[model samples]
Target: MRHIERQIVQLKEKILRVGTLVEEAISKSITALINRDSALAQRVMASDEEIDRMEVEVEEECLKILALYQPVAADLRLVVAALKINNDLERIGDLAKNIAKRVAQLAGEGPIDLPAEIRTMATLAQEMVRQSLDAVVNGDTALARQVREEDDAVDDARQRVRRMVLQGIKVEPERVECLLRVNSVSKHIERIADMATNIAEDVIYMVEGDIVRHRSSDY
Candidate 1:
């Protein structure tokens, strides 16, 4: 195999490895939130630095490829997509840390119920991130489009939480602060899903050579 070809393969493996770590971080953050496990939340927060470091490493590798290989065509697309996905994954890690931060605050507040919608949104967002990475790894545009479509589901889940929290605060004004925390967590999860959609869009661009970031329904 050619030298640039091998480097491209190695780069692919590196990003995929980073993707797996980001996925685990999201999943563990959700688990920690639902179970109210401070230890797990702390674990997620502690590892976030490592995730950031990995993202930097992947980005440096991508720039190295772009400078050294100056690859064209599909190879160039793959490297660019990896660079974008790396940022998205790092942001997702930050979102998960945000969730973990909320979990930490909740631990001090005694027992409080997590809205069903929040849990549902967590699961959906986690799935979106996982499938987004899957679409990239498999170079599946159909799956990428499917991932895009799923973003609507995540948005719906977030809105549902908003509605529920509105009603909840009206009835129990004393817990308004807690309700708002729940609202913030829902928003964080929504952002994570949005980032996943971004990754999926980048995957489509990588495979199909089509830019779909700001395109509408008819695009």
Candidate 2:
């Protein structure tokens, strides 16, 4: 392979490294939350700093490639997508950290029972991120689109959990504070879904050269 192609390959590998880290962080955050594992939650939070560092390094590498190689065609798309996906992955890591923060607060609440919907929402959101990264690896626009479409399932799960929490708070006003934390975790998961959608959108853009409309809004 030529020098530029080699760099592109390295770039994809680096991006995938970050993708995998954020994905595991998301999973561990949910596990810590459900299990009330404060030690594991602290692990997730500590890893965020490393994730942040990786994000910066990826951005710098992309800039270096653009300045040095002036990549064209698919190479340009890959570089651009790398930049966008890097940002999205970093945000996903932050969202996972946010979930960890909430989980740490709820650790002492004693045997918290998250609604089924909340668990489903978290599961779906994590899958979205995982599949989005897969799409990037395979350059599969169809898979990327599927990941984007799955965002709604996560959102639906979120709405259901929100209603469940709200209703629970209405009946047991004394537990309102705890229920509110559940609601906050649900919101964090939904936002993570949004970030996954963003990564899928970028993957589609990378593969098809087609710009997905209203890239930010959830429909």
Candidate 3:
């Protein structure tokens, strides 16, 4: 590989490293919340700082490649995709942190059974993040599209959670506060899924050079 290509490869690797950290954070955050483990929640919260640092480093590397390489064609697409994916990963990290914060707040409260839908939502979002990163690493647009398709499942799960929460609130008004927090968690998971979809779209653009934003129907 040429010098520029090597730099691009390094940048890609760094992004994937950051991606892995974010994915782990998401999984651990959900586990902490469901298990009501304050220590695990605190650990996830602490890891967010590292995730933010990685995001900054990845962005800097992309900028360095852009300035030094002046790449064209697919190389240019890859660099741009790296920049976008880096942002998406950072946002996902924040979502995980938000979930951890909720977990910390609910730590002392009585354990409320998690709605089944929340688990489904969290799982689908986590899968989307994993598949999207794999798609980028492998330059597989088909896998990217599959990640996009999985976002719908997350959405459906979120809607189900919303309905369940609303019903819980109606039946037990005193639990409104706890139910609201659970709803927020569901929303956070949905946003995580959205960010994963964005990353998958970036991967598709990098591979095919075709923009899929605002045109999910075609995919």
**CA RMSD of each candidate after superposition:** 1.1, 1.9, 0.8
Each model's lDDT comes to 0.90, 0.90, 0.91
Q: List model 1 lDDT by residue over 177-196, tens digit each.
A: 88899999999999999999
Which parts of model 2 have CA positions greater than 4 angstroms off? 215-219
How far out, in Å, is residue 99 in model 1?
Answer: 0.2
On a 0 to 100 scale, what is the lDDT of residue 91 in model 1? 96
lDDT for each residue of candidate 3 in 1-219, tens digit (9 for 90 to 100): 799978987888899899899999999999999899889999998999999999889988988888888889999999999989999999999999999999978876688979978888999899999999999999998999888888888888898999999999999999888899999999999999999999999998999999997896346
What does candidate 2's lDDT look like per residue over 1-219, in tens digits?
999989988999999999999999999999998888899999999999999999999999999999999999889998999999999999999999999998878876766678878778888998988899999989988888888789888888888888889889889898887999999999999999999888888888898887895865342
Clashes of each: 0, 0, 0
Query: Which residue pairs clash in candidate 3?
Result: none
As a whole number from 0 to 100, the lDDT of residue 11 in candidate 3 is 86
State candidate 2's TM-score. 0.96
